[model samples]
Target chain A: MITSLSVQWRMDEFCELAGLPAECLIEIVEQGILDPGGQAPEEWLFDAAALAIAKRAARLQRDLEIDWPGIALALSLLDELEQLRAENAMLKRRLGRFLQE
Target chain B: MLEPQGSSMDFKDYYAILGVPDSADDKAIKTAYRKLARKYHPDVSREAGAEEKFKEVAEAYEVLGNAEKRAEYDEVRRYGRAGAGFEVPPGWQRSGSFGDYAGHPGRDFSDFFEAIFGSAGRAGEAPGRGREGGRRGQDVEMELPIFLEDTLADESKKILYQVPQYDSAGRRLADIDKTLNVKIPPGVGDRERIRLKGQGAPGIGGAPNGDLYLVIRLVPHPLFDVEGHNLIITVPLAPWEAALGTKVTLPTLKGKVNLTIPANSQTGQRLRIKGRGLVSKLGTTGDLYALLKVVMPSRNDEATQQLWKQLAEQAGFDPRTEWSKRP
Candidate 1:
C-alpha cells in the first residue's frame, strides 16, 4: 500500500529511516524541532514530512555540530524564510498579472 | 567520478574542494568546511548545483578531518597523479584506524572513498552485512512530479528508477532498473511524499527490501494558482464590464460555468466559488477565488474618445480621493 499524508510511522520505523536514535529524536522533539503526533515516544507517529525534517536535523547536528536548541532555532527560522519566499513569489506573480509590463 | 578506477583513482584535492591551503591546520580546514557546507547544503542553499558542490565539500572533510585518513592520503599523494589519475603504489597499506563518521544521509561515498577506505561506510553496505547475512536493501528516494489537475482526483503515476543490486556475497553489482505504478490520492500538496515499503533496492539473502519515498512536486498551472487547497484564477474584465454588471462564462477545473460580475466591481476584489477548488484527502473541497482585474481597451476611435469625454464630464468621479489623506 502506498502511504499518503494520512500514513505515519511508529518510533522504530521512524528511527530506522531517519538514522537517528530514540534519544536524539526525543531531544529534537523537546527542542520543538519535530512535533510528531501522540503524547509519548512509543505512542507517537511520524509522518513523511517529519521524517524529512528529522533527517535534516540529524544532518545539522552531525555536520554543523550545532546543539539541539541551536538546531531547533535554525530549523524554525529556515522554515519561516522558505514560507515567506514562496508567499513573496506568489504575491509578485499576482501583482504582475494585474500590472502591465 | 567516484567509480572504481581499478588500481588507479583520481587524486581529488580535498584542500581545493574546501578552498584551503595544503598546509592549513585543523581550525582553518574546519572553518572552510563549515562555510562551504552552509553555503552548499541542498536543504538550505538556493543556488543551483548546491547538492553536488556540498557532496564534494563533505567528502573532502571526511578524509581531512581525521588525522589518520589525512596521513594516508598524503602518503598516496607522493605517488603523484598521471593525467588526472592517481595509482596506489605497490604494497600500500591503509591505516587501520577509521573515524566514527555518519556521513550525510543521502551522500553516496564516492568511488575514491571506497577505494581508500573500502565499502564499510558506503551507501549500501551496512557495518556487518557480510557476517550477519540476509542484509536489508538500500532505500531509494526520488521526486515524482504531478500536474495540478491530478491533485484533485485519484491519479496513477508510472515511475522508472534504478536500484542497487548485490549478490549473496554482499559484493557490489550493477544496478537494475525497476518500474512501478503508484496511485496518488487526491489533495496531495507540494513537498509531500508517498511512501511505498519493500519496493526499493532488493535485499540480499532474502531480507526485506527497502522502502521508496516519492516526493511530490506540483507543476504550475497556466490558469489557476494554489494557496492551501484553494485555487485563485484571475478574471480579466473590460472597463465597461467592471463598471456595469455583466454575466461571463468562467472555466473551472471540472467545467465552465456562467458567473455574474456585480456592477461597480473593483480590481483586486475576489469572488469565492465554494466547493470548486482542490479536494482534500478527507473529501472536503476548497473554494475557488476569482480575482478581478479591470483593463482598458488598447485603442479608442474618435467616436469612442468623444463618448468617453462626455461620460467623464457627466460622472465627475474621483477614483483616488483616499490618496489625499497620505501620512
Candidate 2:
C-alpha cells in the first residue's frame, strides 16, 4: 500500500529498506554508482520507489560486482521477468475462466 | 549570438593552424596537439618559428583544455569577427590573460594566447590556487574476473594485484607482488570494484596511501546465464518429452534435480523451482528458472526420420496454424 508519493526516507532509512549495508550504500554514492540528486530550487528527490531501485542497484553491485552497464543489463532482465510473470498470471486467470465456462 | 565590437586583434586560428578540423573531438584535438607539440617543442625542434608554433599549440590547448571556455571561443570565432573593429558584448569583462590565471603551469602560454581564454580561466582559478601540495599519486585500477559459480558460493580467493610503488627518487617502480585474500560475496557480476585500504603507492611524509580498486569481471558460462538472483538454464528437451508430461533430470547448481514437464509443454516455457536459485547474503535462495528448448534432431537415419514422421502424423496438430493467422 506504500507508494512513492506517500513514503520518504533519509539515507540510512533508505539503505535499511533496500536491504543494503550502510557502508555499501555510501560507497555506491561516492563512486557515482547511484545519483542522490543534486540540490536546487526544484531538486530531484529519492522517493520510496527510487530508494527501492537504488537498493536493488546496490544489491546488484554487491552481489555481482557488475559495473554500470552489466547492472543495467541485469535490471532489464529482471524487469522483463516480472512483466512475463504478470502476463502469465493474467493468461492463467483467463484460461481458468474459459475452463469454468 | 551577438558579434564582438572594437579591438581588431589578429587572433591565431589554432585549430586551423594545427591543421585539425574545427569539429574534432577532444581525442582528435589531443592527437593533433601531441603531434605538433612534439615536433615544435623547443627542446626537440631546431626549425625556425618552432618555439612560437609550440607556444601557439600550447595556447590553443590552454583554451581548449576547458570545456566551457572552448565552447565560448568556438561560438565567437564561428560568428564574431576575429580581427575586425568589434567590441566584446555588454557585461563581458576581460578579467585576466590565461597565462596570468596559471591554468596549466610548467608549460606556460604567451600573453597573446591568454587574452581570449582569460575569462574562462578565472572560474577554475579559485580551486587551483586554493589547492596545496604537488600532484597527488595517480589512482590505480585493476580488473579481477571471477566465475559466476564462485560468486554464488561466496568464495574467498587469493588475488595477486600489481601496484606501483615509488622509489627514493620518486620514480614509478614495477608492480610489487601484493597478495590479498578477497572474499567475494554471493551474486557478484562483472565490473564491480573492490577497494583495498592503503594498497596503493606509499604517500609522501605520512600522507594517506591511495586506494587500490579491483574491478570485477565474470567469466562466461557455457550452459548458464545469470539473471540477478535467478539462474537461467536452457533445458534441451526431446520432442517426446515436450509432447507428454514426464519427469526429467535437470542440471542445477547442486547437481541434477528431477523436474516435471507439464503436458504439452511448449518451447520457451519456463518452469521455476522454488528456493533453488543463487543464495543471497540473508540466507534466502532465489528460484531457478528452467527455460524449455525443444531441440529437434539435426541429422536422423531412415528409421528415426520415419518414426518422427509417423509420430507427427499421429498427433494431428498443426503447429503452423497460429503463424498462418498472422498474415
| TM-score of chain B taken alone, every candidate | 0.88, 0.59
lDDT by residue (tens digit), candidate 2, B168-238: 33333555667777777666545555555466555543444554556677665665665667777777778
Tell me the deviation in Å of residue B323 in model 1. Answer: 3.0
Which sections of candidate 1 miss by over 4 Å?
A1-3, A37-39, B1-8, B81-83, B99-107, B121-132, B166-172, B325-327
**DockQ for each of the predicted structures, in order?**
0.50, 0.04
**Candidate 2 wrongly placed segments (more than 4 Å):** A1-101, B1-138, B167-170
Which residue pairs in candidate 1 collide?
Answer: B2-B111
lDDT of 1: 0.80
Model 2: residue B267 alpha-carbon error in angstroms: 0.9
> Which TM-score value belongs to model 2?
0.50
Tens digit per residue, CA lDDT, model 1, B283-311: 89998999999989999999999999999
> How would you encode candidate 2's per-residue C-alpha lDDT over A9-101 as one tens digit per residue?
566545533445566656555555456676531333445345545645654453233676666666666667756865575456433422424
